[model samples]
Target: MAGNGSFWVQIMPAILFLQLLFRAVGTDGASSFSFANDCQYPVWVGVLSGATSPPLARSGFYLPPSGTFQLAAPSSGSWSGTFWARTGCAVDSSTGRFSCATADCGSGDVACNGRGPSPPVTLAEITLASPGSGGQDFYDVSLVDGFNVPVRLSPSGGSAGECRAVACAGDVNAACPSDLRVVVAGSGGVVACRSACDAYRSARYCCTGEYGSPAACGPTNYSQVFKTACPAAYSYAYDDASSTFTCVGASNYDVTFCPRT
Candidate 1:
């Protein structure tokens, strides 16, 4: 009986291999063992047996095929991890390697291993403008080499054109000139004023003004004469030569007004 059992055991491997071969090659011995002929028969057979076995899952192992994983950094700053899968002892005889099947598979967990350091966060491009009062300003804020996370702006003192929107968040106070002010004139027209005096106070003089009707503020035309007249109150003038603002008493005052969209 023992001899008979050994014979049956030997026959089982052959029968199983033949069944797999027949399924793969469809009754044709030619295709059934073509891959086997290319390499050593024993090696190829062992590979085939391993390929047919069911895979096992091991604890703490994350293997992804083509994507990045977020693994915990080791004390040495390098990430390292391993994965293991079990199969029948018969298939385990082969030594072929397998790969993970996904990108960023281990990113969800904080403890998994096998990834590089996190990328750096980049700030978005910032722009500032005085759109004159009663008008909307347009700013095209963009991020350079940045991720998809939301960004915010920290304005120093000047108010944003539309602070409720995402684009208005990053306008720092340093970007805007202190002399520039948004003024509301008669008939509800908005004007951008550059003043020699501090315009934040109601008593300051306005050096140059842009926006409003052609008759009142000369719409887009700046005037230095306004600054001369209102040295103590507010004066405004458009400097045709420099294409900017020029205060009557303040020679160095140079401010530009942006058109509102």
Candidate 2:
């Protein structure tokens, strides 16, 4: 009996080793992303994966008021992508095409299908690190493309300071510059705001040519309008210093559109 007990203990270590190996192989490094629409009206959520990253489960979908959708990143590697809300979307009676008044991707369908949004969009961008890589996740709310709806990116399950939520829940369209305002035809009510670069393709506003460098390209009066409204959002091409945010060991992220606070 004593010899049998000794033999069992010796084999137990090997069994434990095999169990750990199987567990590691079975686990995929994926993160959950929850998209919530808090707007009074319905909004279509659009997603575009980064050039090197794999596409998420759903590229785009119609989200009714107070509705939510969730997606998981590919487990093969780190995932990078941008999410935006397309407001006032519907199937065109004439063309039978799906389109949005703001942030339309021009796909004529619910899925963006590898297409990016047309500017005048509020973008929530994120790059999630692979599991066990010891790398931090990077995320931000960008108005550099433009502003259609208020957005907030909130990370959960990370260390306190690094997991802080970043948001730009301001009414930018209301104060949009006259030249940059995107107004609805009937009511002439401003629905979106264009970035200076989108409004005018000047080298200065576009951050190209001599103004390409961050040192040379400072914020213009146009960008200041966006910055003043959404302080945490990226106002211009070179507004990286304050706009970028990072998190370590986060389990998931909640992206809310038309966030209350």
The residue pairs that clash in candidate 2, if any, are none
lDDT score for residue 245 of model 2: 92
lDDT (10s digit) by residue, model 1, range 132-231: 2222222221211111112221222223342322221221212223344332344132122232233332221222253332344431112232323222
Question: Residue 116 CA error for candidate 1 (Å)?
Answer: 22
How far does residue 131 in candidate 2 sit from its true spot (Å)? Answer: 1.4
Maximum-TM-score candidate: 2
Task: Provide the lDDT at 62 for model 1.
Answer: 22
Report how far residue 169 has shifted in candidate 2, in Å: 0.2
Candidate 2 lDDT score at position 8: 96
* Residue 115 alpha-carbon offset, candidate 1, angstroms: 28
TM-score of each: 0.13, 0.92
> Residue 178 in model 1: shift from native, Å?
46
Cα-based lDDT at residue 187, candidate 1: 17
CA error at residue 261 for candidate 1, angstroms: 28
